[model samples]
Target: MDFNGKCFWITGAASGMGKSLSLLLASFNTQLILSDRDVKGLSQVADKAIALGARVLTLPLDMSDSGSIRKAVSGVLTNVKRIDGLYQFAGISQRSLIIDTPLENDRKIMEVNFFGVIELAKALLPHMIDQGGGQMAVTSSLVGKFGFPYRSAYSASKHALHGYFESLRTENSLNNIRVSILIPGRIQTNISLFALDKDGKEHGKMDPGQANGITAEKAARQILKGLRKEKKEIHVGGKELLMLYIRRFFPALFYYISSRIKPV
Candidate 1:
């Protein structure tokens, strides 16, 4: 896909898929607006993107904070004229069962993973429409496609994204705004390590399944390839992608596998 002279905003740019995508886009002669609560890490990514010949603006803001998002959006509008693409890769995951997980934890995850995402998208929609149109991509999980064990709240948040963005896609079909939902099964990332537990504390462990998954660079390449064709839904993963199809066509087998599969 050609990103030449296009301005793209990436969240969670400090690490994982977001950072990998940022570095890759830098080589594409693109303008970037990178944001993350990790100020130090964000600076590092920005420096590397700059070195790679990308014009980048780093906005250090928390995804869970509305005030911060507002400030960041205003900051973007002030400096940049138009955003060609806005990729939302920032979100918190959960690793607790429903009975053990309280509403507080559920709300917290929803606040960051769902509300924050939609709020930021809503903030940019008007501007994007007024300036013609643009693409918005959201990073959702395989669990987002089907309800998985140990991710009730997390799954709910992603499911909500599908509903919301799918509607946005059709509603704005005439408006020229493209909404792409990125469903990734497992990529080498720190999401599991930082996932919230029953007590709302970090899981603090690198899941073996996640570590064995594709690299963030590979995931980014696949996602970008789908976005290049303006695909509304992009699923990136190995065999894990089969779950989506099985669940769709063979419900009984899918449930059997889901019930026995380890929550890795």
Candidate 2:
């Protein structure tokens, strides 16, 4: 689990939690493949990693497009001997009532958040397996564990990641492949502003709960610790941590209360 000298391929490395993780991993002296659709932002990440004495590669990527993913992965493989770990953090969030949510927007969320992660993992997993071991970490959400109003599509996509990655872990345990699903309740990130609405426009608004959540740096550190321990599931944020326990022991009551909790 030591990152020193290992190659890491991380999506969404431009900012927020992804950027925090990139910085932390660099401090471990890992070779980094930083990817995102923003070339400028990715360049910034690469520069910082280089300054931290880590080998760095910058890749412009569009997670929703499989063709782009294939090309990016191929490019990374050509530049590096192997990927010791892959963190699937590139995703979009949605915040429209299900009945009013545009079907196209919902599909786009699923494409980027679920299918994109799955396809990329499928492509990279063989290399990890061939090496006889590796790690794949996915970012899910608190909504993935339980549905929330105005985020129906997002909830579904994140829930799907949990099921898929958990199964992959079961199937690949003998190969020493570790899968960690991180459920972050509400981190202070651009997620809310970038969340899509029915018209495919940014929500441009904050949910109070999320706005007051943990900082991305703290969340990333906890995530790295969990991945090092090879935990199957990790929930960050105090509110989400409490909810995790409630969901486990009081499913019906939790569902009833959670369903009634409205967005601020």
Clashes of each: 0, 0
- Tell me the deviation in Å of residue 81 in model 2: 0.7
lDDT of 2: 0.88
**TM-score, one value per model:** 0.98, 0.96
Q: Local error of candidate 2 at 12, Å?
A: 0.6
What global local distance difference test value does model 1 have? 0.92
User: Candidate 1 residues 117-155, lDDT tens each?
Assistant: 999999999999999999999988888888888999999
- For 5-110, candidate 2 gives per-residue lDDT tens digits of 8999999999888988998999887899999987898899889888998889888899999999999989988998889899978888887888887789999999
The list of candidate 1 runs beyond 4 A from truth reads none
RMSD of each: 1.0, 1.2
